[model samples]
Target: MTTIAPSRPLTAAGYPRGFKWGVSTSSYQIEGGHDADGRLPSIWDTRCRMQGKIANGDTGDVACDHYHRYPEDIALMKGLGLDVYRFSVAWPRVLPKGKGRVNQKGLDFYDRLIDGVLEAGIEPWLCLYHWDLPQALDDLGGWPARDSAGWFADYAALCCQRYGDRVKHWATFNEFAVFTLFGYCIDWSAPGITDREAHLKAIHHVNLAHGMGVDVIRDLVPGAVVGAVHNRQVVWPEKDTDADRRAAALLDAHWNKAFPDPQLLGHYPDLIAESIAPYVKAGDMAQICRRTDWFGLNHYGPIFAKDDPNATWGFHWGAAPDDADKSDIGWPIWPAAFRDELIGLTKTYKLPIYVTENGMGGNDKVDDKGEVNDATRIRYLTLYTDAMKEAIAAGADVRGYYVWSLLDNFEWGTGYQNRFGLVHVDYETQKRTAKASYAWYRDYIKAARAAE
Candidate 1:
């Protein structure tokens, strides 16, 4: 007795057979009761205490209260006719000290969560780490510390040894670029630091941590499929000038290629070394080169670059030239660039790719009809899917598409202000209302299935 809209009468655009439709979410962003069931403080917990760090002084302490409402959430996913559920496991919850011991209660929660998803007939795509470094680890030098990599490996093994049988799809880390750059260099996120030296050190260690985690998971789960999640900005130049193009190349090296190069090519991007040479150590590159089963790209929008010597990162972002579609988040809705990114990565790495996260954030509210018909979000989803279809037709080995979120939850720093969910969550009442985007997506997938 699942609930969904009637399939629309429309011809389906050809997509690769067996292309998956799934929804994604993260631990800290959605799951509340931060200290419940033996969970301990994470770096995010400490960051939340810093005044002026988050908008509206928001914290994920009670986000969506998913800790108490997961069964209902799973039922909603079943209603969406989703094939997979991509979610993250909070590190501190499992390893309170980040390394020394395991908390049975913490592991029990995910054990139940996975079992529930499986009972709902949804494949579990578990992400090992998603920016929630245990507070104990941060106290021990955080990701910049070489020991943190080993600690992560231990934790990954622990999770796999326990739950690998039920979790078929695994992702090592989600968006290392955003965590390292925004958290360290920009000091905009948790455990904030703005030192260039710390940034480079954290970058190498994060890469090594990902590799070690993958190796551990592979050992524990003999048949588990592994990938690393990344949010890559498809960079574009503002003009045809050589300087602008050069800036775009640099932007791509830092934003898109840095995270994937070592895992796939056994080396960091050349421009990475050139840009951060002063802070690199002798054998850091060798430590980062670990093979992965797949490359997960979490693309949202493209960044237009122009040469700017005075810019903080030696590059500037320009607004999209054309405005055929735009999200309430002010992001351009360009589907063409999405295809280009897939093809670009395919040519560069020649590996299987999955669109791990893609969706639009909007100002959403239920109307008089008790319907959250967010037409703008629906349009964004359609155009983005069209982009994915084009890439598949062009022979890109793209495997699946997981929408950015399952529920409107705590968006970091912005807090609950930015809503990026197919289902809207009223923060006060904790009510789940499916939006127009959700209804449209259900129809789209059903049409695709009917066409098959």
Candidate 2:
């Protein structure tokens, strides 16, 4: 048995007063009943139907049944003493065809969810997109087409008009690099299309859509705080050689700076400028560059890059040193790197930072007494939160920290194989059992609040 230490006070841990603590979840990952409430198919629903596309051939047909049991989930969030709940709204649910007709039932669902969140005294942080693009939009060329910007703006406008009164914190999109590069360039995710040119086009269109979405939300919702979330990574070279160093720099440009730089700095990185120049048009930069209220960062760990002359991008991801501790997903546990990444973002963007999504997937299982002893996850949270406190003390203006998930839902591509949740869910019965980590988090938040 893994022994968990007693909870330490956050003041002693150095977390500042009013440090927002919350949990995050995406729509398709948790809210199954995929065809519920007049909703149409998304790219992910289609992808899961393809042979061997998802692990174990598992589809999110009834993932945790959050669509029907959200009240229970909200109760779970309340129990955790969460200050906020960060969730994404499914595009297909709101607009079956991605445009033209509005689905009142879809809007009504979020209407109730938002009300429940507010009733629980937790702030609602709504992310407009979380990679579940409507299949209707995919049919119309999806993010690769220039028209996607308009489609996305329309969706955002509708959402703002309906939920704006309650939701003040809005994120335009989540992890553009992952969806564009993996979905279009590498063929790992939905609407998978492995083409370099298409990848570049999709990247530009997504950026345009983000800027357009921001404008729509600001125009439609009074007092709306809008921003975009990027899966930021600190790229490190595997060896002290010029080739590896160059590869690391290139990877950093594409993986880290590509989406954010255009949005925040109004220009593309010099390393990738020429390659993406063909798709850039006049006034696009001006449109992409908008004042954001905060910079949402979803960090996991650093990526080790190495020179691979034959690789499509002239860089390949290498394994971390064998001696390093790794998460269940094989991601390295590097808290110092996490701190440095936050400090670096503060130095560059000068916007308030939100650790929007940070957690470790664990090989969690229920014991005979029907409790999950996720001590490893608890440990991961402690170390990472401590690192975040260090970054804040080092001059990073971090306003909040939200763990990746509140419940064990469907993990994309990996299906339900990887679990990253404070509350464990039984796939067979849809039963939620709060793990040791949940108790740890609740106590930590209580201590933090009491200290304040």
Best candidate, lDDT:
2
Q: Give the TM-score of candidate 1.
A: 0.92
lDDT for 280 in candidate 2 is 91
Error of 2 at 189 (Å): 1.1
lDDT of 1 by residue, 1-452 (tens): 11112212232557656778899999999998899988899999889889999999999999998888999999989988888899999999999989888899989989999999999999999999889999988998998787878988999999999898888789999998888877776667889987667777788788878878877887889798988898887788988889899889987877777778877787668877765655456766575666677888898888888988775566667667764467798887778888888877777787778889999998898899988988888888888888877776666678778898899999998899999999999999999999888878788878887876
Predicted structure 2: lDDT: 0.90
Candidate 1 Cα outliers beyond 4 Å, as residue runs:
1-13, 237-247, 274-287, 306-312, 316-324
Model 2 steric clash pairs: none
Q: Write the per-residue lDDT of candidate 2 for residues 1-452, one digit (tens) a residue.
A: 11112222345547756789999999999999799889999999999999999999999889989999999999999999999899999999999999999999999999999999999999999999999999998998999999999999999999999999899999999999999988887668998897878888999999999999989989999999888899998888988899999999988887899999999998999999999999999999999998899999998888899998886678878778888889977889999889888888887998888999999998799999989999889889989988887777777778889998899989989999999999999999999999999999999998888877
Cα-based RMSD of candidate 2: 4.4
Tell me the whole-model lDDT of each prediction, alpha carbons only.
0.84, 0.90
Q: Estimate each model's TM-score.
A: 0.92, 0.96
